[model samples]
Target: MKRIGILSDTHGHWDEKLETFFASCDELWHAGDIGNIQTADTIARFKPLRAVYGNIDDFKVRSAYPKVLQFRCEEVDVLMTHIGGYPNRYEREALALIKAQKPKLFICGHSHILKVIYDKKYELLHINPGAAGRSGFHQVRTAVRLTIDGANMKDMEIYELPRS
Candidate 1:
């Protein structure tokens, strides 16, 4: 089993609370809008980071991370992007990727609205960890933690902090 910490839209801000909250996680996944390279470096220093570049990310971040990330964690196939929509409202590129990749977990960040839902049509879990930075309209910054064991994902948890 691996404990995964997920967040997005940091917009170049890093909080100490985030470090503390994700201390026990085995890996970190960032959906996008990391803002700058330093923010990505900070998270990578903390743990292994799997990430995608967001619209606001600079050339450095985009050079380091892909626009779409697809890989397997344990026995689960996971796909991540920066601007992917959820369920029936998916972005055109994201919808096509989802259909082609058929991942068990689909992760994205952009709307800065926390959402966790099961897309019954695609048989996948969709997670948008919202915005973890202070630069957005989100009143409460959020992150997520979950345990991925074999082919099952469980023990999901959310971390919310007032935008500073």
Candidate 2:
């Protein structure tokens, strides 16, 4: 069983609370818009980081991460991207990738809105951890934590803080 922490849209903002919330996680998955390379380094220093670059990221960040990341965690196939829309509303590129990869878990971050939905048609779990930075329009910053054991994802949790 591996504990995972998921977040996105940091926009260069880092909070100490994130450390506390994700302390137990063995790895961290960032959806995108990581803000800067320093922030990404900070997160990587804390734990293993799997990330994709968002539209807002600069050349340096884009160089550090890919636009789409596909990998396996335990027995689960995972797909992650930045602007991937959820379910039937999936973005063109995202949809094509989904059809090709057929991942069990699909993760994205761009809307700055938290969502956890199951796509019955594709038979995958879609997770958007929302915005964890102070720069977005989101009223509350959020992050997600979950346990991926074998092929099962369970013990999901959320961390939220009012934007100030």
RMSD of each: 0.5, 0.5
Tens-digit lDDT string for candidate 1 (4-37) = 9999999999978999989989999999999999
**All candidates: TM-score:** 0.99, 0.99
Model 1: worst 10 consecutive residues (lDDT sum)? 15-24
Give each model's whole-structure lDDT: 0.96, 0.96
lDDT of 2 by residue, 1-164 (tens): 99999999999988789999999999999999999999999999999999999999999999999999999999999999999998999999999999999999999999999999999999999999999999878999999999999999999999999989
- After TM-score superposition, what is the CA distance of residue 40 in candidate 1 from its true location, in Å? 0.5
TM-score of model number 1: 0.99
> Which sections of candidate 1 miss by over 4 Å?
none
Candidate 2 lands at a TM-score of 0.99
Q: What 10-residue stretch in candidate 2 is worst by lDDT?
A: 11-20
